[model samples]
Target: MTKKNANTQALHALGQSLWVDNITRQMLDDGTLQRYIDELAITGLTSNPTIFEHAIGKSTAYDAQIAELSRAGKSGEALFFELAITDLRRAADLFKPIHAATEGVDGWASLEASPLLVDDAEGTIAAAAQLHRAAARDNIYIKIPGTAAGVKAIEASIFAGVPVNVTLLFSREQYLAAAEAYLRGIERRIAAGLDPKVESVASLFVSRWDVAVKDKLPKDRAKEKGNRLGIAIAQRCYRAYRELLAAPRWQKLAAAGAHPQRLLWASTGTKDPDAPDTLYVQALAAPDTVDTLPDKTLEAFADHGSVGAVMAPDGGDAEAVIAEHGALGIDDTALAAQLQQEGGDSFKKSWEALLKGIADKAERAGNAASKAGLA
Candidate 1:
């Protein structure tokens, strides 16, 4: 419906996987999510606090469910999970056959713990395990932030044999840290006489990098603005990902049947109207990497997304391009830190807003019940 001979046709033909980056209860129940899966070649899906917050606050879709949960004394974070897991589990079920068909290499959905717990190592791990348990499905990957605390949680959770999607990574260093945590966790599991083969992914967010450096990228060219920063960063990270997998440590891990957590490209929507909506989708195509794109981006890509040259595993010009920005007094590390902090803060804001909205709904529902009883 979006486009004939869609970009996904080329992407799937080339062996790269495309994943839809958003989900909703309506999407699941109405077969919209499944239709995307069938027509769009979408093998996976991802969700976060902001996504859940919006899906809950902006629609009557979740109201009846929320009302019932409130009656059972569920509120706040617990209430939110009840809603999200139910939706994700259904989506995961739809993807289950694809997952099995691919031998666990594809067809997965992600659920992140509270963004408020990003800096809380203990809290993140606890929430991750709790959500994983509550979901009770194998195709679901519990999402943990790739913050300092989250790195610790990633290692621990993986060791505990929980599949994880490491989210919020903004740079190569951050991605490497998350990878190392996975290594340590798998190594520990090996030492404990347990299977070290933990399924995981490092989600490298794109577009935000451009948003972080909108003015810094060489505006000397028309295409040099908007999403270029994120693409360059992702190109660079893909190079690192190639190198790390070829290293001896990872070779040993791979030899032991551990699935290397693939690097996923996230936040791929083009924010600038001047740029092609499918900018991120076209540039970051590589085998074994996942592109979790927003719906608009997906539609744009499906319409006109042509097969571009696959990203070089060697990371062509990424460091130098990033260095050009770094030379402009843009502290790359500081920017990563700032972005992460902002991301966490935004999640917290959404979480609180969702809680307040839920509270209001519960109050109104209570009043209606009271009126009905009195009548």
Candidate 2:
């Protein structure tokens, strides 16, 4: 590996698992995903409807399978999951050695449950369990949003032994709620004599916090506070994560052989053009956490990113920074709710587009197969 790639390895050495936030069948086929693991220390990955929309809509890498599945009488959500699970299973196998080496602490891939189920706790629960079983891979997580309904589903899913990646969280409170769900599930499992080691991660989205408030900052201090909200929020959440791990409740779980649900930093890519490309990656480095970087952010960091001081376990200056933002009329609590709702809405859009894209591709593939007398 070049010195540039070693920079990324150094961050991994600091105890945070580097996970790529995007996946494409092209990457898997062309060896790009494996290259990331071998050279840049990426141990895991996470995917969303937006990523899948772009991947399938823009590339022909999945064309053959789409055509075959189309001919086999599959379409819509069923067809989509078939495609997604195939890619996730391949990625999971690639990470299997790391999964074994780390004893399941690292080396995992995530597939999000249907965004349409964001408001249906029962539906989300069933979909998460179904997806996990369909993937049939021990190292894969079925992502469930951390919305209120999703929180309910999360507890049930965890109890059902479905590994979960809690997504779309935007604040400490949201993170705590998700963490509580995980705890409750594990506690129930231990009570029922089941293994307490069901794996999980609560993903707090960092950069979107800044993006939502960038224009709302006071004009005089915009330069000082422009991109600070996200990091401050992450610091606050990191402190909560550290505290939870040390709490008596979690201690009991640990004693019962349960693994603490790791806190994951998601949406870490910088959105402001004026900010450093590696802004989130550099600032959110913390031990026992996962940072899922977008492709551009991962490549930028691997090429030139430097790991600054890891996040303070006590959340140094986080409250003060948040207080300053509050003085500017930015209510972090309300904004967190808004962001979560907006994220769900956004994912719903992507999910619709992804299904439509798949349907359109399948149609064209079927038509072509018909013309060729192969259907």
Candidate 3:
């Protein structure tokens, strides 16, 4: 209802849930997060290793807690989860009203499973269950990658009643694979007479596709193809998402109380400096989908972005656009695999750095506590 953020409110009015892609304890403490919810129609949030690395490593807000946890003999992943879950629990509580009002359709917060378990299905599954249990909140989603192994874990985790946010998806095929896994899990739950309303969102990384192919474009065609791949891919995936929901398979599950796994647009922040700041946000607006925007993009959209026509359910021009890029030597399939692998690798690196940063901080905190005779 705030006049200043009318653009964002309009988008929400279109039935798309706008979720912030970053989370930090500082935002929670300072009421910035709450203001976004109140003014900008932000209904949900998500966090990953990189976001945590920056939040914990770059800010002193978490130092005292890290110190206390260190003093209690928690270190490494155990210490990190304590900090993460604490922040996410606060966020989840803030969104609890939205979650309840939507009957669990919106107002959720996501914390990713360990990137180190990207290829370890069993490890990912166990970690997801453990993290979900630890968070002890129904609205908190344990993010799992959509890797070959992760796909296996997704089905099992969903069957186990852990709401999953499937991350790092890049292509229509990959998205379908993750969706299939979700369907299988829900099917099993129905067969076993368990609750079939396990919620989920399959995240498709948009800007990363453009970032991956930007430099590879032919010089003459660069201008023409600069920032279109990601949108095209998203459009294609959105079509699949729409079709999937209308299928008899999903309809049956729906009758059995299963919720449709919403398609989420991730990595939506414009990576190209030349592209409009709110390019992805404006382009991907549609009903029944979630678009997770970075802080800058969210602010930019709130200020000046206009919602265009919603995406075509039939994927208008997406295939032709994809073919154009393909003819220029960009292979969508291979690139999707490469992007996913690179994304997993990048997150793994961040995970290592995050753990190391925590260890270093904990050591400093411990030494300081000892010097003060409190250890």
Candidate 4:
């Protein structure tokens, strides 16, 4: 037989979970998502405002449902989330098997809280719980930004037994902050004699770092530049992740039936045309971690990607790479903060656009319903 999903299967065999960072009703209804799960070993899916905005705005797959919900008087953020929960619930059901098989380690779908709530700790906590309950699936994670307020929300959500995917973290310190929030939540649950098994993941964006610094590097050093910053940051984060799991704090939680909050690699798609399509996927391959890639990146990897040496637990050359960039006037800390803020703002813009698109679509849908004597 020909090599089918050869590279994806190879990566899966190497102990890393590959999740597609996109979702749509068409993919689920047409079985494309299922095929990815069965053939390409895609164990999970993730969604953000940007992804949902495109999936709903760019296609008619959601038209009928939008019309139905519009008739039922749902619009704005409520309408957007109604559509999102529908799609994610379907995806979560598809991944239910892997979720059960791995005992909640591998298969999971993520739905982000509204980007507007990034700075509202109390609102974020309420939103996460409500969304998780709205999704009503064990495999669904309510995504919260890993901002300071979001850290508070993360802890509160987890303590309330809602799974979370902490997004927008760009540095090792940021990742640690998210992880600490998760630990505190679990620790509280343990203290309260709760289940203490709330699942979570800290998402560290990668490609954006390289994209931010690519033009800053010297022209002659262009070829050696794109992959350095992102990979270095990821390596450092990965090292901390490994160390955190090995620490006594985590061991106590483990003994009390807690699971490690996985370190997720987000924004793995190569932003540079000159870079390898599988660059981040190949470089960040490590066990006990998750890599959420865009559909194109996943397809490119499935078609021709290869899994090479796994990332070293000791964070090989991460310090050196950061030092090199520091010498070049690139403050990794400052850049990390900038990237996190920019990511939040970009998603907010997308969320607003998506809501507008939904309003417009709902109006058109209502017009058609009136014309057809169905109003």
Candidate 5:
């Protein structure tokens, strides 16, 4: 499709990168991802335990690799990473042209560290380092959740020159915390005479906030009150992100070759069936940010989406929207905390299930090999 015919191309023209949040070996081997890059201007992708779980559990695409790895005595997390890293490396290679063309601003793929390390700061850092090294691709980002302890790991990881995608951020405050951690890492790198051009993105999750508050909102203005909270929060975070980019501190780092940490909008798929499929994707159109869409959402946008008025850096109506919710007894702080914790827990569960899926696949493969006298 030509750029004019594709709304995703229009989004790219507006300067926001379109990243597909879901990935599978089927997609990569079948050229689905390359087509996205060619036609829709998809410059990057992000991954988490849930996406990996679904990709592995639902497909035989990985069975042979799993069996081979199992035969080599790799199991559990080790086997999972081998599978993940192999897929991501291929994806990273496909995006490498864009990575070089953009000088590292776009064309990136991410692999999250084990969700089991959420509370383990030191372990998180070590795992991030190991994963980045093991992946051995500069275009890949090692994802770390933006939890309190994760913030510490983010700083250390960035200082060590590991490109990071800071994930699971919920609100403006959480986004700022991730930004702070990223900035400190950049600043330390500058001081230590290291390259301050480390790449990072603070991923503020949208859509989930709306899902969380929809049932709790007043019925009278529920249309106005529901589903819009996430956009408002995202706009507010965007305002903060713009402010940080303009700060003297950031400017100083910029002078020393540091790149601003771009704000990424995650969870852009609309959870409410009543809402438009492209709600978050269209609403979050802005320059210097990212909107990571699910495959269905990406296709919907490509088919029928239009760019809306870009978010006001001054946070147009975001404060009022949030304050109105606050007046309705929606505690933003409490809810953000709960969301972050729940997000971590959810990922941990997915990680466990992913391991179980791999184990099952390996066992079945072993059984089939023995039956065929091939073991």
Candidate 6:
């Protein structure tokens, strides 16, 4: 395999896409997003409420729009969507050519619904469809968490012709569940006489596994094994993905015109400052999968990156490494559950914070307008 960023590009050459796990208005306004697409081989983007909260909170670029939307009676979630959709649409358009170029295999942008409904299967599905339709862009995906209820929602969303990006997955099991949901949804489409090839991707989170286990064990075990845990988990999921693609059940779906649900690596940034900056990028590089890097990580890889050997087709030593952790008294299953739950909560918090920021900004804008007699 080539060195770091070289390996990342090699992975892309092998059919996997490198996506940035972030989005921002400035990225769009200043052409940074376009540059990433052009130079870094990043083909997609993903965003959550936290990303928006930070983008809007620490800047004044959105204040004028908040003021305008506030005057138009939009506030809170409604206002948030208005702003988010605008940015996502711009990104979707930028990726539209790639979408068309790849026949919808690449060039996608993802926006998640409110995280508060993670357990509300129907509600999550409803919100995902509503958001996707509102965006009016085919390359845009509605992100759904991979909770049990979320799996249900994912299946239903795919059946209803909504492209989905499954988020918040922690374990190989959870990733498989998300994949099953995507396939079931597509099968339902074929059964219902609808086109079954709605594009989708299942995003398995990396890095956080190391974060959760960092302090649980002694020095050697707890010491960052660099990207060992995350890359292992990802490798296992990729093996399963390859099996699913080759399975007889899925083969029938493909025969009927359904697209395979691609695997995506989420949260690819290193949690350990001491680890190589591109640890996740270098180790988890594989074909037909995705590694979604944060902005800083992208720059790091672009500048001084070298991808290591290609991930093993049989997952290399992932299971044994996981077993080593298990021997150290870590319950991998329970931790996966905990990580997923926390992931859901984390997003909900960000969503709430984003809404609060919007509300506050709108209020301030409203006052400014009132004082200026622009109201």
lDDT of each: 0.86, 0.94, 0.95, 0.92, 0.92, 0.86
Q: Model 6 TM-score?
A: 0.96
Q: Please give each candidate's TM-score.
A: 0.95, 0.98, 0.99, 0.98, 0.98, 0.96
- Candidates in descending lDDT order: 3, 2, 5, 4, 6, 1
**Model 4 bad stretches (over 4 Å):** 1-4
Stretches > 4 Å off in candidate 2: 1-4
Candidate 2 residue pairs in backbone clash:
none
Q: Give candidate 3 regions above 4 Å deviation.
A: 1-4
* The 10-residue segment with the lowest total lDDT in model 6: 1-10
lDDT of 1 by residue, 99-135 (tens): 9998788999999888888889999888888888899
Top candidate on TM-score is 3
Tens-digit per-residue lDDT, 225-291, candidate 6: 4347777888888788888888899898888877788888888888788898888888877888878
Q: How many backbone clashes can be found in candidate 6?
A: 7
Writing each residue's lDDT as its tens digit, candidate 3 over 60-157 gives 99999999999899999999999999999999999999999999999999999999999999999999999999999999999999999999999999
lDDT (Cα, tens digit) per residue for candidate 4, span 1-375: 334587898888888899999998889989889888888889998999999999999999999889999999998999989999889989999999899999988789999999999999999989888888788899999999999999999999999999999999999999999999999999999889899888898999999998899888888876766578999999999999999999999999999888899999999999988888999999999998899989899999988889889999999999999998898889999999999999999999999999999999999999998999999
Off by over 4 Å in 6: 1-8, 224-227
- Between candidates 3 and 5, which one is better according to lDDT? 3
Whichever of 4 and 6 has more lDDT, that candidate is 4
